[model samples]
Target: MYKIVEKEHFSENVVKLIVEAPMIAQSRRPGHFVIVRIGEGGERIPLTISAADTVKGTITLVVQAIGESTRKICALEIGDCFTDIVGPLGQATHIENVGTVVCCGGGVGVAPLLPIIKAMKEAGNRVVSILAARTSDLIILEKEVSEYSDEVIIMTDDGSKGQKGLVTAGVESVINREKVDLVVAIGPAVMMKFVSLTTKKYDIPTMVSLNTIMVDGTGMCGACRVTVDGKTKFVCIDGPEFDAHKVDFDEMIMRLRAYN
Candidate 1:
């Protein structure tokens, strides 16, 4: 069992939990994720590792309680333990010195992008991060993300904090002013689709993390299959990250909206 050592409410519906999993913490890379189950008969869910403290043997998970499984996980207290905590799974982000890179994150997507941005910074790239949410209250990890970013731009749809626009607007500002080496975006499917569309116009290399529906997470279920460059790719193994320009957004959108 993975023990929950600490928990904090980042927002009304978002919770951050630290789990005592030394092995996973030490093994986890910037973009790796884990499959967790709250208890017996519970559904397996995949979440990105927001941060890891190797020395402390803990991994941080920032989760938005959006559905049944997620809500149950969010309801867990500091002392609660998970029935299953499997991985440092999937491939890690490819970090390299890509000159000026922009890491665009929206809402809970900020949690996953945080570590990637830090890794990019350490790779000797000048990192500009754009974090956004519907309102100020929905934003998370503002202070932590700022530490790693060369410049951090925050956007809120309601304009309660930072600029009054979408994260794509921030990307536009950066793209217009400077030569962007790459753009990595993670957020709602619709938001990622738009971010990819926006970056495509500038011809900058762009990647996006897809949060498709999954069950086994081991690539055996084929539930999270997505089309990239016209070929079927399983998000679990092939990538949660893929070339944004080549991904079939229309197909992905149809699949994502089927039951919703």
Candidate 2:
């Protein structure tokens, strides 16, 4: 059992938990995720490792209570335990000195993007981050993300904070002012789709993390399958990160709605 060492509410529906997972924390890289099970017979769910502390033997998970399983996980208090937590799974983000990199994150997607921003900056790239949410209340990790980023832009649909516009606008604003070597976007599938489209116009290389349906965290389930560059790839093994331009977002978006 992995104990929840700390817990904080990011918003009304979003909760952050720091869990005791020494092995995973020591080895987890940016873009890796874990499959968590609450208890016996509980549903398995995939959650990205938002941050990890080797010395503390802990990994952080940011969860938005969107459904039954996530809600259950979020409802647990500090000192509670997760019955099963499996991974450091999925491919880690490829980091290098890629000149100027823009990391775009939407809602809880910002949680996973934080580590990548820190890694990029450490790799000697000028890192710019864009954080977007439906409203001011939904925006999270601003202070944390800003610490690692050279510049931070906030976008909200409601004008409660930052600019009153979509994340795509923020992407274009940066692209127009200077050259961007790469863009890493993680958010709703639809947001990534449009971000990919926007970057494609400028011929900028972009990467996106796919949060798809899954049963087993392993590829055997065939639940996280996605089409990339016209070929089938399983998110669990092949990638949770893919070249944004080549992914078939339309199909993936439709697949995400299958249960809804």
Candidate 3:
């Protein structure tokens, strides 16, 4: 059983958990994820590894309670133990000194982008991050994330905080004003798709993380298949990260809505 060592609410619907998983903590890299089940009969859910402490034997997961399983996971307390936990899955983000890197995150996407931005900064890249939400109350990790970023831009759709605009505006501004070596984007499908569209025009190399319906997380179920560059790829094994220029966003949106 995997125990929850800590839990903090990021928002009304988002919760952060520090889970006790020594093996995963020791070896996990940014962009990897974990699959967890609350009990013997609970549904499996995939969560991104936002941070890991190898020495402390813990890994952090930021979960947004958008559905029944996620809601259950969010409601779990500090001492609760999950019946099953599978870990450190998916390809890790390649960290390198890529000159100027821009990390764009929308809402809960900020959680997953935290580690990536930190790693990029540590690798000697100038990290500029964009955090977006509907309002100030929904924005998370802004303070913590800013420490790892050379510059941070905050955007809100309702003008309740920071600049009043979509995250795309910030992304476009940076691409136009600066020499960006790499752009990393993670968020809702629509947001990522639009970001991809915006960057494609500038010929900027952009990467996006995909959160498809995953089962077994090992590529055995074929549930996470996504078309990249017109070829089939599994998000579990091939990548949760892909070149934005090659991804078929429309197909991904349709697949995600299959049962909805």
TM-scores, each model vs. reference: 0.98, 0.99, 0.98
What lDDT score is found at residue 82 in candidate 2?
98
lDDT of 3 by residue, 1-260 (tens): 78999999988899999989999998889999989898778888988899999988999999998888888889999999888889889999999998999999999999889999999999999999999999999999998799999999999999999899999999988888989999999999889999999999989999999989998899999999999999999998998999999999999999999947
Candidate 1 structure, TM-score to reference: 0.98
The runs of at least 3 residues in candidate 3 whose Cα sits more than 4 Å from the true structure, single-residue gaps closed, are: none
- Choose 1 or 2, whichever is better by TM-score: 2
Per-residue error for 163 in candidate 1, Å, reads 0.7
Off by over 4 Å in 1: none
Clashing pairs in 2: none
Candidate 2 on 19-73: residue-level lDDT in tens? Answer: 9999999999999999999979999999999999999999999999989999999
Off by over 4 Å in 2: none
Model 2 gets an lDDT of: 0.96
Q: What is the lDDT of residue 236 in candidate 2?
A: 92
- Candidate 1: deviation at residue 63, Å? 1.0
The local distance difference test score of model 1 is 0.93
